[model samples]
Target chain A: MQLKTQTRPKVISVLVMEDRIDAATAIQFKERMRDVTKDAPARVVLDLARVQFLDSSGLGAIVAVKKLLGPDRALELSSLTPTVEKVFRLTRMDTVFTIHPSLEVAVASAASV
Target chain B: MPPQPVSDHDPRRSSLTLVFQADPVSIRQALQGMLTCPPLSCLRGEDRGMAELVLAEVLNNVAEHAYAEAGGKVEIRLDGDPRGLRCLVVDEGREMPGGQLPEGRLPCGPYVALDDLPEGGFGWHLIRSLCADLAYARVDGQNRLAFVLATGS
Candidate 1:
């Protein structure tokens, strides 16, 4: 899985370039995320607008990436497709990570703060 | 195109069976190969996405816990209807932890600390929540799990 990253004023949005995030791609996704987020700013937004299929393994990968970012830095997920959002809501991970409807909103919030 | 609502006597009901290796690649290939099915193909992307997500979780569970990545076979049977789809997964690798399914609910946890967050237990929760009906049985030395989902075609 290839991740696209854009660094703005306060937030760096990492756009996930994939349609499916399941068992087949979860490991690679985590590895790629670790590399992309190793030196990110204080707050980062993960843009998942194109991710239409996300399962448990994929969710775990996200959590693992969060841990890699450490305590001070924050990881927020944005642009969740309905299916991906359903998985997060069902697992109650929606409450764990801050969510936004779009990357623009997330970035704007970062600018506000 | 949308699939019409199905009845008991509807001729559109169809069944398919296949044996797959208990592995992620095989399970993914199996699901990918199913895109041509009528009921699944007719459903909207979100519904199909949920179905595929649930199916992938279940299959990965079998490969991880049951077969332990050594080697095993999973027999899958899909019952297709114009209104919905039912799937049966059978494997001989292992039984449920205590001969029963998990609570099928998310275990509450504090979302505060990074160490306290969960990573693995979410699979069964996702499966149980998305599926309409889920049944599990350990019969004749095989772990059989049957689940149904609405196609919303």
Candidate 2:
């Protein structure tokens, strides 16, 4: 799995090209997010349109990334598959982060904030 | 802790082995049976959640890592006493990722920082956190992951 990063002004976008985000892909996830967001922005959106599955580890990763951004920046999740959504709901993390239907919507929503 | 008395009709008093191909639905069914079968009554709601999380994560890992490229077989073994449950997942596919548990868990306890959670490193962390003991071994072209979850009486 490869984590690609792109910066657009106040928003940092991360694209995860993986069917599942588990222990194997979590570190690369963190490094890429950290590398892209070295300079914090007002909003950070992760485009998980391709991810079909996520576990607690994956959830923890996102939570860690959210913490890295601290309370100032907005962290938004986009394009979460149903299984992935189930995991978020199971862990009750859906309430912790902002989730959107698509990357465009997530980024746009973050931009609005 | 003392060994609790086994209840009548307890299935876990005897070792159980249930093997399923890389089918998610079947896997869940088997898990449902294994977790509920008599002696394992200790697995209630919260333990059910924990089992679901652990099973989903590990089985998905097997499906992707073991059978992603070419279909392969996955074997699940359950062994336990009245004290706790042990699950072993063995897959005949790619080799297990090589390395020790991440350095982050050096000081294990609650109040661990969420920010310190490594994005990808959460697999072992979650397995370690959810289970009392975890061991991994690659034997004869198979990745065997053993999980031990204690049910405090």
Candidate 3:
């Protein structure tokens, strides 16, 4: 459940340094996200490029993080691998949050907004 | 090059059986072992992804819901063919409520409030969507779940 955090002016990008987020690590992932994004700006883009797999528990943790962020702070997602993307798509969580193809695009969009 | 024929009796691609403690950490290791082995290892792209997702959900359910705090052991048998992999999961934990599987409806709507957004209950929905012929039975004192994950080949 390692996360690399890079904070810019308007957005904070937390890159997941793990290959899989499943039942084994979902709770740890959520707790880490909360700590990393505690002082996040308006947008927090989670970069999941290295994550090759995410189960339902992992998805729930992400959603839990979003709710933890509340209405003012937005939790966005970027760089979803095919399998991670499939989990979001299948659960229809894709429609709940804004998803970017890459971290750069997510940061750029956040900067403009 | 022509596609190689896949046979059920092929010596290199035989059914995989795994027995492990019903816990998250053990289930994770089991999933890794299953995916890297024959038949599952032979899957590509979406098919492989689906297999992992479905298996994770099923195993996690057994650990969290079925076993709960009581703890138990789970046995998984996977037989793969051209159409898909047929999975059988057996556990001695408590049977599913009502002696049946959940309907696994999508938890949230397109316009649900942020606070109302569901943080769980998506496991069964995912399993149902990714697998076919999903069935549950309580034979003797064990819970038996069966499903087929198509490779789309």
Candidate 4:
């Protein structure tokens, strides 16, 4: 559950460094997100470019992170791989969060807003 | 000469059997192995992804629910073909409650509260959505779950 965080102005982007987030690491992922975003800005963009696999447990963990951030802060996702996108699509979770096609786009949108 | 028969030994028809402890770490390792092996390795794009996701959900259920506190062994037998893969998972642990599978309804909706948002229950939904001919049975102190993952090939 290695996550790299970068803060820029109003938004912070956290890059998931690992290739897979499954049952084995969902809890850790959530906890790490909490720790990194504890005092961050109102918008958080999670870059999933490196993640190759995510199970339901992993998906749930991401949702948990969103809830943890509450209504004040937004948790946006970017660069979802083919399978990751499928999970979000099948679960209809893709509708819940703002999903950007790339990290640059996610951050750029944050800059504009 | 007559057309050749498609025997069980045909290279196109293959199966892989894996037996491991019912634990998250072990299940991860098993999934990695399966993806690298024949038939599963032969899958591509969304087909391969679906296989990994479905198997992960099923195996995780065994580790988290079936075994729970009482650790046990789990066996996975996968038969692969041009169309898709047939997966059978067996565990020598607790039977599914009421000896039946869950209905696997989606837990989220457009109006659910943020606090009430589900952190779980998505596993079965994913399994049901991606798998076909899904079946579960408790027999002779073992839980057997079978499903077919279509590769669209």
Best by TM-score: 3
CAPRI-style quality class for the chain A–B interface of candidate 2: incorrect
C-alpha lDDT of residue B13 in model 1: 72
Clashing pairs in 1: none
Stronger candidate by lDDT (2 vs 4): 4
Model 4 C-alpha lDDT per residue in residues B13-56, reported as the tens digit of each score: 78999999888899999999989987788788899999999999
Q: Evaluate model 3: give its lDDT.
A: 0.92
On TM-score, the stronger of 1 and 4 is 4
lDDT of 3 by residue, A27-84 (tens): 9999999999998999999999999999999999999999999999999999999989
Between candidates 1 and 2, name the one with more favorable DockQ: 1
Candidate 1 residue spans exceeding 4 A from truth: B1-12
State each model's TM-score restricted to chain B.
Answer: 0.85, 0.70, 0.93, 0.90
Model 1: per-residue Cα lDDT over B1-153, one tens digit each: 897666765533767687889898898898887656644555678788877787788889999899998769999888887567888999998889998888866755655589667667888877877787789999999999998987764
Provide the lowest-lDDT 10-residue window in model 2 chain A: A86-95
Query: Can you write out model 2's per-residue Cα lDDT over A16-61, one digit (the tens) per residue?
Result: 8777665446666776777777785788888888876567556767
Q: C-alpha displacement of A22 in model 2, angstroms?
A: 12
- DockQ (Cα-based) for each candidate: 0.74, 0.16, 0.93, 0.86
Clashing pairs in 2: A26-B119, A26-B120, A27-B120
Show the lowest summed lDDT stretch of 10 residues, model 4 chain B.
Answer: B6-15
Least lDDT summed over 10 consecutive residues: which range in candidate 4 chain A? A89-98
| Per-candidate TM-score against the hidden true structure | 0.90, 0.50, 0.96, 0.95
Tell me the number of clashing residue pairs for each predicted model: 0, 3, 0, 0
